[model samples]
Target: MDPLLLLFSLSAATCAYLLWFYLLARNLTGPKVWPVFGSLPYLFLNRKRMHDWIASNLCSTGGAATYQTCTIALPFLARRQGFYTVTCHPKNIEHVLRTRFDNYPKGPTWQTAFHDLLGQGIFNSDGDTWLIQRKTAALEFTTRTLRQAMARWVNRTIRTRLWVILDKAARDHTPVDLQDLLLRLTFDNICGLTFGKDPETLSPEMPENPFAIAFDTATEATLQRLIYPGFLWRLKKVLMIGSEDRLKKSLQIVENYMNEAIDARKEKPSDDLLSRFLKKRDMDGNLFPISVLQRIALNFVLAGRDTSSVALSWFFWLVMNHARVEEKILRELKTVLTESRGGEPKRWMEEPLTFDEAEKLTYLKAALAETLRLYPSVPEDFKYVITDDVLPDGTFVPAGSTVTYSIYSVGRMKAIWGEDCMEFRPERWLTAGGDRFEPPKDGYKFVAFNAGPRTCLGKDLAYLQMKSVASAVLLRYRLSTVPGHRVEQKMSLTLFMKNGLRVYLHPRTLA
Candidate 1:
């Protein structure tokens, strides 16, 4: 035989063998696998509506432990790499997030993705380092003085800063973008509470602020990483291309502002969260180092600002769509406030809403819960399998695979939430006994603030902040959606409104 003919024959045979192997493996895997692209084609078909696409697939493929795999071709590699993805199953989530948590650290992959923005903060760190930071944060967050101070600051921001902006928009008959306003308010409030310095984001003129600008840019760039993984970025970093330069610039802006704030706080020693974190001594009596302080400050900026703002923005949007629900919330707010005060127009914003006060507003809490159910700010979370384990439902997850829990999808699951799962009904959260609803387990179902050991410590503070702002604003102004304004979701680590939520605020007159 000719040498060229022999070579061609050999190549054809090898291709045939690999094709047969892939088809055989696909049959065994139980997930719908396309020939060469695997699941990528299907995913691309529904890329515009990714969450719904995945949810529908999960539903059809059977609930809980159903596994799906996707293959991506890489240059210099002989065979394609298989990546497995899964949906919400409490026990499976528990195994990944809590039970064998040590085995499944955030890993270097996530650290690289978030490092340019979050650095080595608790949100990205793992192992003993994460534990130390979490412990210190929890201690500071739950401290009486810090809690009291935060409450006061949140209430004051709601009353003075936030309301003033809304009032101006209402009076001038200018349509307000509630999403942008909420973001600004939360940024200002969190900055004040954490660093004892105001960014003045809610000012009348809305002056340009580099920190806020960079923060928004950083968030958008971080979301891009989800579509293209960080390893790809690391490769690009080698060549020094694409958004790498932009990301570096944003990080520098954030770091410069943080370092300045830290320096000022160190000199002044005020009673903000940063000051407390700086002065806080560990069990071994060592103060948090400057690097740790910077990490903590950046973590607070990410956590404290985005979560509350996103939640509040969604809550208001829900209220606008559901007027009857808004009526119920207003009724509940009135009853609670009236009972709290003896019909006196005293300083409502100066005092913190006590745990008892928060409890009394059952409908308000329910409304917020329903909002979170439908539009969780942190829509999805991923956990990589550390060890091979069988889930409660008896599905086996192999080691070195990533499992994603769709908090957004779980909230809308018919199996979990009944037939009306997709509806934004606040009444679903009201118990038959007329009390606020509670989850069966805090891990997967009600995972808006996450669950188990890594549950968000700022959950209570977030609720308080949202309630204060909602009550204060709704009592004074009636917000209606601006005509033909389409509100859509932007896919990011945080669920933000793609187009700002434009609304007309009509000031309510006291009867």
Candidate 2:
């Protein structure tokens, strides 16, 4: 056969196969699907703008769409794979996340992608392994002693460490990366909580913590595995080349820190997570090995370190941009302070407010919730279907397919949040004809902390951290993004600001 003739023949066959699928699955509507390759090429081409692209398509498709990616099915190197459905529909989200939660575990595919970093921790594990970790962590988190410890830790850190940094930045008029600062602060806080010792990532000189740096690199590399085809990354790993090699090196750095903490706990046990985990044993009277300990430590750092910091960064950005929101928060703070001090605003301004006082700043809490709605810490998540399941909207997802729920896309769905969904309106979270905060009737609709059995155990702790920090900051300062500094989102496992939030802090004026 002539080369041109063969090329033309293959093109014609691809078109024919696509038309055949078009005839068969007419209801299947999403990105442009091709023959054997499915939608891989399109996804590859638009990878840079993936989150935005997915959100736009979901909005247009009435909050649900499927993306299918299969190899061209070549005998030598390629094989058939991938049936992915992404939904922002509240009903579908409820069904997947809550009602039929048992049918969707993180599954083998997710574990494969995150295994290097998360291993068999609570975030990555399923069944009995997850249950044991969950129970152990839950016991620790819900204790009143832990609550008192956290309150003391957070408030003391804010007054002594975080405030001093921002105060210097405000006085010196130096541009600071607020996100970077928060990252360090949270890193220190969570490390203290996890190991009963601070790594001092928040030192005035801001020295780079090797474990923190390596953990970040490892997580970023882990996310790339989800983007590239599994086989290619695995091949690269086997060869000890490229991102996989970097990932391996980074994981070693992270594990060293974990092991050091474990050693510290043994020599001098304290009331921290590591100490508690050391005392725990599973069903067979088998304690979790050091590897399991490492996984749990990594999970705590990932959950506690990044998520709250990133969220606070975004919240500050939103509050700065919307003066009304900021003013409202200030008003709420003033009211709380006045009530607490019995009308001594001057003295209240001078003294650092306690967590109990911060708790009454309802408007500030609502604003934080709204910020999360716009920018969830974990913007998108996927679960592998253990069995064939029907979503509430009647989407038929076959067994072995991965159904993803986009917390980012779902937040922007007008059908779920109404016509003004795109607007940065914290008022949506407030009560009708009143300024009081009101939560959504359907809990699954707002999944910042997730829903059902796997709902984040760290929810209260996160709030304690956020409320304590946010209230303290709002009472003391006014922040604005530095002029001409670019604020963009980074492509990662978590929703981190790409360049970080550069800002100049100004002390608030009060009469």
Please provide, for model 2 over 1-511, each residue's C-alpha lDDT reduced to its tens digit, 9 standing for 90 to 100: 9999999999998787666666534545667656556567877887766788778878777644433333332222222236677888878888888898889899887899999899998999988999998988988888987877777778777778788888998899998898998999898888888888788888678899899999899999888888766878889999989889999999989888888899989899998888899889976889879998889888988999999999999999888889988887787777777788867656765556676776676777788889899999998898988888788777778787778888998788888888888788887888986467798998878998998888898887787689778877877788888889888888888889999999988888754
Candidate number with greatest lDDT: 2
* Model 1 lDDT per residue over 1-511, tens place: 9999999999997788677756545543334565555566765566566666656766666455345565443222112124555666556676667777776677665666777777778898887778877898888788777777777777676666777787788889999888888888889888988899988887777778999998878877776665553466777667767766677788789889999999999899888889878877644578877777887788888888888899889999888879899888877766777788645535443354554576577788788988998889887777666677666667666666556677777776777777887888888777777566554444466789887678899887888778777777777778889999998887667888889899999987533
> How many pairs of residues collide in each model?
0, 0
TM-score of each: 0.90, 0.93
Q: Pull out the clashing pairs in model 2.
A: none
Q: Given candidate 2, what's the lDDT at residue 369?
A: 88
* Candidate 2's TM-score: 0.93
Leading candidate by TM-score: 2
